[model samples]
Target chain A: MYIHAVSHYFPSEVVGNEHFTRLNGLSSEWITERTGIRERRKAAPDENTNTMALEAVRRLFDQTAIDPSQIDLIVGATYTPYDTIVTLAHVVQHNLGVPDIPVISVSTACSSLINAVEVVEGYFAMNKATLAVVVVSEHNTAYNNETDTVSGHLWGDGAAALLISKERISDEDMTIHTIITGGAATSGKATTGVMLKPLEQGVLMPHGRDVFINACLYMPKVSLQVLEKHNLTIDDVDYLIPHQANLRISLNVINTLKLPETKLLSNIQKLGNTGCAGCAIALSENRALFKKGQNIVLTVFGGGYSFGAMLVEV
Target chain B: MYIHAVSHYFPSEVVGNEHFTRLNGLSSEWITERTGIRERRKAAPDENTNTMALEAVRRLFDQTAIDPSQIDLIVGATYTPYDTIVTLAHVVQHNLGVPDIPVISVSTACSSLINAVEVVEGYFAMNKATLAVVVVSEHNTAYNNETDTVSGHLWGDGAAALLISKERISDEDMTIHTIITGGAATSGKATTGVMLKPLEQGVLMPHGRDVFINACLYMPKVSLQVLEKHNLTIDDVDYLIPHQANLRISLNVINTLKLPETKLLSNIQKLGNTGCAGCAIALSENRALFKKGQNIVLTVFGGGYSFGAMLVEV
Candidate 1:
């Protein structure tokens, strides 16, 4: 499967640590030094997962001439969907005026986009579809706790959309080659550590260091596995688009892989970690950095101890 | 793709309208009349998606005599997950001691299990895996508001697992022949009169009447499409296992198809709507009813406006 175009959308409202300073005695430097996030976009009360997805898909529509109706499948990847039963993908299809096509929602935390891509690839390979659209959106701020400096400063709200098709324009048009994807629990205790308790009314409590260590270790190993499968070395990869979990984790993987800084792509410095939207946001921001025949590696680690890697040739 | 064995896990804690009447002002007859759910199970506070899935998978393992490590892929179907990230499939793998494999969580609401099965078939057809597991779990009660009679009485929690493989055992074994799947949606407009807020959390608000109409019209049509592709007719089908959405909907579909009641397999009267777990649970409950060379039709419709139908020969 080939990625035809990528786009992302962040709400206009930006919230920085300064705003949290008033609610919880914290400083911008303290938040930035630890999480590497200066400011993150916060959706207005009226905006939601569907709205964010719409914004990104609209830009994607503008970038490509492919009509929404031409799309054979729609996959929406998210964790914080507005409803637990009704998927945001259907909402996207409704907004796009293409309701008859199948729309599937996938949740793999930050790795959701990769999971979505994997499903799309499987569908295309089986001749089940010709064109597919994957939209990853997250409103983590809705689940954030202002007093919890660890997770509060590390998350933002955003969405991204990518169109995949079997009709490749060129052999170098960034085809998804292979993926090594799975997850494991390191919490030792089953069910206890993985549970997220609601705080006050809507706050989300997360174990940051646990997630951090898992991402740092699992991502590089999976990326290498994918690379090895294609008989390609790390040196052959032109770019690394690791999930925007954090600058530290991404940097650690890059260093461990011994990849140069020029070969790495990231936007977490400004966009923060958009949960499921992280990888797609990174791809959308770095779409221009890719050229025909260039190879790129995308890796992600998210909740449920989920980590995945995909190798694609541009 | 061939189904090796199927198993289900129903939570021990059964909660009927009698239980609801004691806790919240409600009646069994009222609940039954509105949603056709006589009773539903609620997992203990300690029970979750992963544990429930593990229970079902263990039963499958016991019956099939297959080691967990031998499974090449794990497809988890659910909307309510313990974590927003990381799929519950990995949790099952970790507990079962399975090797690292490509695990994904599919959320197409009620159609999720069938969607996962569709994915499994594609992967098998592509020679990507020889053995795969599809686990569907839903914890709707966790999100249901006791005060909301509409949804509270309609939803249930349970899990089911199906072992699928490319190695067909015998002509007597059930095998998927064809799947016709897709979805449709309406813009969230008051004028559409196709929207209903069923939860105070406002996550999965759906118009029940609209969904019923869509299912009644699309499900049988898709089933016929699958049958036509396979050069079969309704008379050739020995049984119909429709998604356990509602008794009225199922009965209406049966009437429309003009199929005999003896040819239809149903468990909604006891299990209610278990979301993604619906199809697997129905199959497992009625396994003995199927014989070799007998054809069965599985149809589903759920949130995302997603609907699908598949023809399988037992």
Candidate 2:
């Protein structure tokens, strides 16, 4: 499997930390220091998971100018969906007016995009599809509880998409390394405090300590395992694209792995935690900065005790 | 991929048609005649999508006496999940104490299981997973609206599990035909009346007429397309396993395809529509009757305006 292009879309609303700080009786400096999030984008009143995702995919198509008829599959990853009945992928395909294709939605919280990448890789391997698109659209606002400071300020709305194909289309296209592996540890779910429960208001309460600790432990472990399998070390990785859940968690993983701070790539400060789209969006924004041949390690941990890591070359 | 074993489990509560006949103005004979549903299972007070699915997989393991360790991936298909955060796959893996594996939840309405099978097949084709488990556990009782008679009486709660391996383990193992293909048409969502709107009651009000007309058309078309790809026709099919939404819809599809009535295997008379688990549960209950080298076609349509078809061999 190879990545032909990557793109992202965010709503127009740029919400600053002052809103939460004033409402929760905390200073802007405190919020910034705690989460390293100065501002994040919020979906507009009319914007939604489906529309944002559609725009991101349209942007990918615009940049690549790939024929829409050539795309044979659409894999959508989302934890916060606009509607439970009409899938995000179907809405996207219908809106795009693309040909009838296999549109599947896979949910494993924030690790969704990587899992979807592997899924499309399988399709390519089996010759089921030659060209595929993977998109992650999340409306975290639907699950945010305004009064609950822990989770309220942590979520942001956005969408990201990537075009993958079995054949390398151009010299600029990046190939995914053969050392991709992902799995989850269920014991992490037993730590009850960190959970996204469906309340009357659709609020997701998170235990900040438990989530931070578990993410620090698993993200590094999985990243190292994927690297070790390829007979490589953290020093061999040019860039570390960890899930932008929190700057502290990302920093912690870097310190644990003893990687240089410059290698840590993130956009959470401006984007917040976009759930499944976090790391993929970061990659899309940072794609131009990478050389033609550089090793980038993508690691992620999400709600529901899901964690995974994959190494790709750009 | 080859199916090593298949097993299903239903809740203890057997809800007879009389429960709906007395509430509404219809008689038991009218209910059976219209939908061919005499009774359906309802989950107990303590049972959930995860518990029901866990039991189904446990039965598969016990009956086959296969080491649980051999299973490397778990893909759970469901439209009604207990929580959006904790995937049904993660919960099942937690309860079963299965090793750390990729636990993914996919939703394509009632067509979920067949789509999941194709996803796992891709994994096998790429050698990403050796032995994978696909479970369709539906708790339709969670979304049923007693007042909306059209959709309420048409749902039942049950779960089914299948162990699919890249290699055939025994002489009795069933191999999936090499011609498996699946895709969805999105134009159906444009129909106005047939939609599942999110309401305060958490109910999905489906338009009966539109669903009937479309399922009758697309189900047969996709089924024939898949068979034609393999140089086979409906007459060559040994069994036609249509989604157990309603007996009327199934019969309409059979009439359109001109498939023999005897070749149409169904359990909707006893197990209403089980959502994503419908076809899989029917297959599990009827697996013993299947002869070697039998050709089976599974066709399904779900509320999200999604539909697909798969051809398999036994």
Candidate 3:
């Protein structure tokens, strides 16, 4: 499948450690050192999960020139939906004037975007859809504890939309070469311990170290699998877009893989971890850096102990 | 596609109008008159969405002698998932010991079972999976407000599973003939007014009159489209399994279509509306009513203002 276009949206408001210090006793340097994030975008009072997704999808439609009616499927990957009854896909379909097509909502935490991509591949493979749109949006700030220095500074609100088509682009345009994807849980005992907010008393607690350990170990292994599948080493790849869970984890995976600095793409320093939208947002923002036939690897480790990787030739 | 077997699970505990009378000031006669439901089942405190789905899936595996790992795809249709982090399909896969295969969780309200069928059809069309399982489960009791007489007594908790395979048993071994699917919203001023729990006052308040009018008008029309495409008439159908949204709506549709009384299959009087599980559960329970080479029609309408119809030969 070829990615015809990609777009992302981050709200206008920015929250930094100074704002956190006013709410909690944390310094900017301390927060930055712990999570590799200095600031993050926050949704305005009126902005929401649906609004962010619509912004990204609207831009994608404008850029791709694909009519919404031509899109056969709409997949929304998010943990925070505006309404459980209606589904976020319905909101997007209604807003975009494509209400008759089949819509599905997927939630696999941070790896959700790839999961949605896999589903789109299934539709394409089945000849059920010629064109598909995947919208991944998350409001991780809703799950943050303003007083918790670890999570507060490590989260952000944003959305990304990618338009995929079974019609392969010419080699001169762009292409996806191969994908190697799999995930496993750690005995169902190594819990990430992360919880969504509006929790009672001690509900929302996470073992950040355990999560870091899992990401540092599993992601690079998956990335290597994709590289091996394509018979290409990391040295041949031009860019590696890892899920923006944290800046430290990305660097750790890069160093462990022995990849060069110029090969890594990241936006967590400014955008923080946007949950499912992290990798897609990074790719959309850095599209200019990509060249025809350039090899790029995208990997993600998310909640539910899920992780996946894909190799694309751009 | 051939259906090897079908199984369903309804919680053992049944709640009658006597139970509702104590919680709300509703008379048994009034409840039975308003909706065709006389009683409904609620899952035990320990039973959840995953457990209910597992129960139905186990029955399918046991009856078909199919290994969990051999099943290529698992599609779970539900509105009440345990958490937003992991899809209920993953929980089902883990519980069933089929963790490697891809799983998709789809939410199309009460039409989810039919939607899952369409997805499996696509897979078979693409030759991706020789065998697939589609599970529809609902724990509607969790969202019911005892005070809301309109919806509280109309919903039940249950699940159903179908084993669809690419191998053909015979030319008429439960093959999909045609599926006409679409959705339409009422004018901008009109809304379904169906509110999900824990977010919007924890009640299911639907505009009963509008929903009834819409179902009576649209359900038969879609059914006709499916029959017309198959070059058959209503007189040729062996049975009709409409989504168990209400007894009155079903009867109204039957009267308008002028179908024979012996040809309609209904379990709503015994099990109430089980949301996405309604059509599947009804089919599973009433399979004895169908004969080889007989035509059957399944239609559904639900909260997303969505409706679909499919014709099949059993």
Candidate 4:
């Protein structure tokens, strides 16, 4: 499979650390030192997961003209959903005017984008669909608890769209070599570590240490496994776009892999954590920097304690 | 792929239509005439989506002892999720003690089981997983608005588990021939027809007529589409397990397909609409009747306005 185009849309409003500091009594310096998040984008009150996703799809269309009729699959991945009933996939399919294709919305929490892509891979492999759209959108701000001191400032609302094809449609299309995802919920703190109780608490991380430890272990571990499966090594990877969960986690992955910090591509410093959209947004941000024959890997770990890695050859 | 085993679990609480008559003033006779439902299963106050799903999986284990280490994939399909963050997939994975496999939760609303099976198809085609479990679970009662007159009586809490293998494991194994799913959200009444607002008015069918109209049109249409895709005809099908949305919809599909009423395998009269788990639960209910060389088709239409048909040869 190949990526024809990728695009991301972030809400226009920039919420600086001062906002969280004022709301949660956490210092700006403390927030930055802890998470490396200075300011993150927050959706307008009227905007949400679906709107941001639509804009990202519009951007994908603007980037490259795609025949809406030929698109056979649409997969939306998110945990913090706007409307689980209407769903991001249906809304995207409705707005994109794509009819009669399989519109599936999936969530393995923050590792959802990889799972969505894996869903597309299934369709492509079955000859069920040739052109597929994997839309990753997250309205973290919509479920953000501004008063929580632990993870109050760690969320941003954003969406990313990827136009993936069963085969290379153009020379610029990047080939997806391998994608691997697994669950570790059997381990400690998988359920209680990060919770999104829309009715009770918004989004909270009660055991940040457990999450940090598991993410640190699994992200690099899965990255290496995916690399080893393809007989490739970390040295061959040109860029590593880890899930934009925390800058410290990404740094840990870099340190474990023994790569320079420049090899790590991230957007959490400016955009906070956009959930599943995080890695996809970072990929879109770095799309122009990719060169032919360069290898890029997007490795992710989620709140369900799910982890995944996708290898892309640009 | 072939089915290793199929199992279903319904909560002990039987919610008869008289309960709806008491709550929403809809007579029991009226409900049976309108939706072909007399009574439905409701989970106890403590029972939930995950617990029911785990029970169904345990039943699968009880029926057959498969190596837990070989289960490489677990796909959970549900629209009415208890906790979207931890997700049914992760919970089942954690409870099953099946570590390090791909755990994905997918929703295309009530047509989710077919989509979940399709996800497993992808993993199988890619050689990613050989042994997979597609767990269809729904906690619709948790979100059902008992006071809503339209769809108040059309929900039940139940779960079904299907252990599918890439290759047949035994002589009794049923081969999945064709599975086709599509979205119809581009058409009218897609979004607002069947809504599940967790915090607001829970599970409302504001456009029951639109849902009924579309369900009647697409259920048989996709049934024939899947049949034709495999060069089979309606005459080849020994049983039709339509989505248990309503008795009226299933009867319409039988009429459209020119099949006898006896050919229709239904459980809606007793289970109401179990959402995505409905058809699978029905299949499990009638499992013993399936004979060698018999062709069974499970066709479904869901609230997201998604439709699918899966053809299986026993």
Interface root-mean-square deviation for each candidate? 4.0, 2.8, 3.6, 1.3
Worst ten in a row by lDDT for model 2 chain A: A190-199
Which sections of candidate 3 miss by over 4 Å?
A18-30, A143-153, A168-174, A177-218, A224-233, B123-128, B168-173, B177-180, B183-193, B228-232
Candidate 4 TM-score to native: 0.98
**A1-314: candidate 3 lDDT, tens digit per residue:** 88888889999899887887788778888888877788889998677777888899999888765677787777778766555556566567667676556666666667778777876776777666777788989877755667775565677899999888888743433555565433343324223345441212211436777777777877898898888978999888889999998888999999999998778899988888899899999989988889987888899977655677888888
User: lDDT by residue for model 4 over A259-287, one digit each (tens)?
Assistant: 89989998999999999999999999999
Candidate 4 Cα misplacement greater than 4 A, ranges: none
Q: Put down candidate 3 lDDT per residue, B15-111, tens digits, no spaces.
A: 9988888888788899889887889999998886768888998887777656677777677787765555555565666666654455666766676
Clashing pairs in 1: A82-B203, A83-B203, A99-B184, A109-B85, A172-A314, A174-A314, A293-A314, A303-B85, A303-B86, A304-B86
The complex in candidate 2 yields a DockQ of 0.50
**Best model number under lDDT:** 4
Candidate scoring better on DockQ of 2 and 3:
2
Give the CAPRI class of candidate 1: acceptable
User: Pairs clashing in candidate 4?
Assistant: none
- C-alpha lDDT of residue B5 in model 2: 93
**Total clashing residue pairs per candidate?**
10, 0, 0, 0
- For residue B2, model 3's alpha carbon misses the true position, in angstroms, by 3.0
- C-alpha lDDT of candidate 4 relative to the true structure: 0.90
C-alpha lDDT of residue A264 in model 3: 88
Candidate 4 lDDT, tens digit per residue, B1-314?
Answer: 99989999999999898998888888889999998998999999888888899899989988776876679999998888777778888888888887899999998998999999999999999888999988989898887778877777889999999999999899988999999999889877898898775546578888988999999899999999889989999999999999999999899889989999999999999999999999999989899999999999999988768899999999
Off by over 4 Å in 2: A179-181, A190-194, A197-207, A229-231, B21-31, B179-183, B190-200, B203-206
| Ranking according to lDDT, highest score first | 4, 2, 1, 3
